[model samples]
Target: MQPGEPSARFVDIELEPGDLRLRTLVPADAPLLVEATSAEPGRSLWGPHPLGPHSLRDAQAALAEWDPAAPGQFSLGVLRDGRLLGAVGLIPERPGSIEVAYWLRPEERGKGIASRAVRAATLWARDGLAVPRIWLEIEPGNEPSLRLAERVGYRFEQRVPRHCRAWEHQDADRDTWHDCLIWTFGTGPA
Candidate 1:
């Protein structure tokens, strides 16, 4: 909530890098998000993220609350050339701080899409959102995510145990108990 900002509502955002484009998430995106993450060799983001088969309807419901022109929680659709890529978030929490997270389609991985989206988010959080701290948490086992966090200028802060819960799998032994690595950027908020 700021003096003047968009009301809590979904935004239509479009970011283009050469031939690629990133836009805000929409309710129609629910199925695509589900499909992308559910596709095989998907061990990438599935383990630690709560998004799963059951998330489609729920994610769609949540789309009503994501606002890009506002100064609060933001969830955006990751789009490239009008195709759904994934999602990215810069959540408002801890006052003057936000937690940044991004997930890309398996086929979209390794193309630096997530990195670019993250960089865009960091810039937004810093300038658009006027936040001092842009933080992110990555499951210890997700090396690529960790690299993205670091590559985006987020520095290693601390390890928080069981900081993330993986609800996708039925096997408890999947050790869904994740150790989270916290990364901070720009001198973090006081």
Candidate 2:
């Protein structure tokens, strides 16, 4: 959707008392976001992004679309004590489904941060946005991410070939699509 066009879906959410807050990404978070996403681990998963060189502009662009007056495919910074720990977002991937994606800094791993963030965002999509189905698609080899999805009650729905081409740089040719395990929350697993 165009910027400023009303989608009326994404909304701010608070996860933990004052320690963890899921809120709109801000320009100040650009540098940290760039640093996090540019790492080999993150880059391999999210593919190449412009955040490294054009941090401010990139962050602004990321947040610009989610104006309070108009919102769609909103991204949130997972903040702990006002410092960005990671990011989680909900993007409308189909007519009746919203997809979830998340990442945390290496230093932030193993702390349950990703789990909390994903859980909060999924609940917001379900209760706040009244979303009927939430999807979490994981690359077959991403064991940690898959485990996190299971922890949040998302059950395996299906496996699809060539489901995630954007997840890797080599896949840019579209000839190396990775198999993905689709998991769902609202729609019970088969």
Candidate 3:
């Protein structure tokens, strides 16, 4: 497990508490993914056009891109009683550290699910994967996510100007960039 190496250990594992489990997303979960991402907040966060998979085909195509065994990234679904609520993604950012991002069904927001899921994932990254550092890169205007990061015990580290740039999904004609706030979890070696 060298620094910045993706852990294959995440490929077939499930993090559990019974009430809410984090597991790998399967093709069968595409419909649920579409349902969760088809609404507000998710629509904006995940899209600007096509508005996040209007059909099963679209959702499955998107799901196909998530490779659990890929070199430096993986995504898991947040499930409660077999119902998909949202997803959490982990991407290696730099040596000895990884960045975590999450989103929930629009209707599921503010119920503390995000905090619990994040805590579980970070704990797994530290204890299960031996990752020494975990980070959350959030947009400055996303107040909900900022609060969620704090509730999950991440401390504000700094605000980075124009830390990210990307084309709007499926819309190469439009691209955007924004300032990001970096938050770090207080665990493992610093």
Task: Give the winner by lDDT.
Answer: 3
What would the per-residue lDDT of candidate 3 be over residues 68-171, giving only the tens digit for each residue?
A: 65565667788887777887887776656878888788788899888878888887777666688899998898899999988989999889997765545555
Clash count per candidate = 2, 0, 0
- Name the runs in model 2 displaced over 4 angstroms: 1-10, 26-32, 35-41, 44-54, 64-71, 166-175, 188-190
TM-score for candidate 3, please give it.
Answer: 0.79
| All candidates in order of lDDT, best leading | 3, 2, 1
Per-residue lDDT of 91 in model 3? 71
Model 1 lDDT per residue over 1-190, tens place = 5512545334444466455555555555666656665653433222333444426664555554554554555566676665667778767777677787777776778988788888876776677657788888888888998888878788998899987766666766674677888888868643
Off by over 4 Å in 1: 1-18, 28-59, 65-72, 168-176
Model 1, global lDDT: 0.66
Specify the poorest-scoring 10-residue window by lDDT in model 1: 40-49
Model 3: worst 10 consecutive residues (lDDT sum): 40-49
In order of appearance, the predictions have TM-scores of 0.74, 0.78, 0.79
Report each candidate's C-alpha RMSD, comma-separated, in the order given: 4.3, 4.2, 3.6
Query: What clash pairs does model 3 have?
Result: none
